[model samples]
Target: MANTSVQTEPGTRRPGVLQAVLLLAGSCMPVLGSVLLTPILPQLSAEFGGAPGGEILVPMVVAIPALMIALFAPFAGQIVDRLGRKKLLIIAMFAYTLVGIAPAFLDTLPAILATRVGVGITEAAIMTVCTTLIVDYWHEPERRAKYLGLQTIVTTLAATAFIAIGGAAGAAGWRTPFWIYLAAAIIAVPMIFLLWEPNKADPTDSHARAPKVPIPWRRIAMPLIVGLFGGFTFYVLVIEASYLLVDAGVAPTDTPTIGGIAALASLATAAGGFTFTRIAKVGVNRILPVAFALQAVGMLIIWFVGGVPGVAVGAIVGGAGSGLLLPSMLTWAVGSTRFEERGRVTGLWTAAFFFGQFLTPIIMGAITAAVGSLPVAVGVVGIACAVAAILLGFGLRKSNMAPAEEVTATV
Candidate 1:
């Protein structure tokens, strides 16, 4: 059901290495705001303490973007469908750079948080468009899988670098990391001349028209449901690992130690992402159980052992599984969808995953409160994930008619 009719050769003969890299670079931009300011939360908290709810609001500057993506990505997806992917992407990147840098000059914490929301809105457009274009640019299943995997790998790696950069920039001043937003301008330049709309109506030919397709609600239902949990599992370690480290006796101010742990986890995630294409051969049904099991085991290790080494080991194991989770979800959501619907579907996929991410802390907090232990709460979520994986494997096995049906039918 992959859309094979579109003329992808907009300006070039076909998508080349440069085009693939450009799209991957776009994917990386969405995650930049996630951890780019983590190292400086303390500084922000101190500077804004006089403001009402500053303790709570100051830290949100980093977290609000993902929440915004969760809330607004679906709308962005609708825009991508009605307008065009290239236009939205170009605008989002430019807007991201502007809003991202707004914090550097703004004096109030609320004002900066407002800019962060703008950052998220633009990122919602960017991530959805980037992912949609990946499917559009490549119709072949193997190539699609390869690019998706590469996209995840590149983004995870960039996140690690951004964390370090954030730390270095944070040392100069709380707002210094905001300067990195300017890099988007450099990326936008290449996009202007190189990025092309694949499913767009031709400007030169009045007769040329793209066919419209209805959204396949039934086809995407399972993938969205799975993606929600997949996102939660993907982010559990990143959001809570620092606190786990502190619980293990590392000083709260030991940013280096905590950052190092995060970097190591991201490396594990990159390793997992690199394996996506190879693991894909087994089918997504078989893959999820193992991925979730790895996550379960990693969480259990951190829960029982409770230390830096334990947390690191858990992160490595969990990170590997998380690495494959996203590409698998993307493949499932779009494997049976047409090119025309890819943008809207991709937006839903982005929303599902990010909403899961936004919900993780609140859900995990509830579990922790109920159990009165953070490690145990993480462990409980891990157990739930493992159970879900097992049930999904069995259900998919029965529902999938053939090997090829695995990705489209039940995955």
Candidate 2:
């Protein structure tokens, strides 16, 4: 059931357009920082003198920041709720900008890894706070949906652009792309000037604040489960794409081209998200199952189809499904929570999302190592999604939560 006390104004009634843009920019920086590093892993490994399990190190570098984000998201939320979103966002962006540039100067693998962890921590702060602020600004379900889609679109587009840029820079020198983070500081400067504090007064300002209601774990459990599955699917698609292409006989030189093809599939996700507002009239409940089904089918296609085109098709299908599912799930999850607890609930949601992302590489790598082939490994992920879809189907059927329309109507 949706929490009745969290006053949800119509999302169309949001306060500031500039603030929204700035928040979106802040949210997208970490994504850009992460994806831009994808093509540079081999170069970094070679430069460092191959350590044990060095081949996995690059992935670890990419995934670990997400792992830390998952681990610390709750704390990040508390800090935001207590300290205010704008202040925390500024701190995080500054940290992100600095840490992003650290690798250019640091030569050791450990030093780079340490900096990545710092970057992840800052990312958690920015992502959690930004999400809370989005909820604060946009109250109408449909409009909120559109903004969320826009957020996904911007991050996807930025990541795609940065991947190409990173690869080019990596070809020149491995450390060059880290300098890209400097742009985040530049992007955040205007955001800091424009973004307003949330209307909800900071609770820390007064000791006489009313006693808080306990968060309802039972209400949020189903959405959290869905988020976890979504994250897992996302990571599986991202981590396995390159290997899936390589196994199908594509040369290493062709990996970036293939990866770009897969990454381009994210555009479908953006489109799907945009399409979701229209689809909601038919019912999000009806749409969600179909979305998960598409994801399952996409994963199945990747498992069965091996070449570059196959990978591209699979990515498009799965990415579209992911694009659809994420906004729907987030809307459901946030709608279910009280306003006072939105930050914490969002934190948990972020944690679940990153946890699934964090687990994908390790699990898929283990499966690939054990089975000795990419197809078998991807097949395992397919099976996992199939199982998750079945569970989601059951959850949807049993769920008694308010319809999104009702939620919007109240707003």
Root-mean-square deviation (CA) per prediction? 4.5, 5.3
User: If scored against the real structure, what TM-score would every candidate get?
Assistant: 0.89, 0.88
lDDT of 1 by residue, 1-411 (tens): 222223445542356666787889989998888777776666675689779977556656766787899888888888987887898899889999999999999998889989999999999999999988777776566677778778888998998888777766776778889999987878988988877876444432221254777878877888889888888878788777766877788765566666777777888788877787667767877777777887888898888877888888988888887887777777777655666677788888888888887777677777889999888888998898789778887887876521454343211
lDDT of 2 by residue, 1-411 (tens): 222113234322234556667778787876775677766655554566477776777677778888888899889878766677788888888889899899899877888889999988998988898888777666556556666656766776666677767766666677888899998789778876666676445331221133555666888887787778788777677656655666677654443564466557767666666666556555556667777877778877877876767777887888788777776777777754555677888888888888878887888788889988777677677777777667667776677764856233221
Give me the candidate number with maximum lDDT: 1
Error of 1 at 335 (Å): 2.6
Candidates in order have lDDT scores of 0.78, 0.72
Off by over 4 Å in 1: 1-12, 42-59, 200-210, 401-411
Prediction 1 global C-alpha lDDT: 0.78
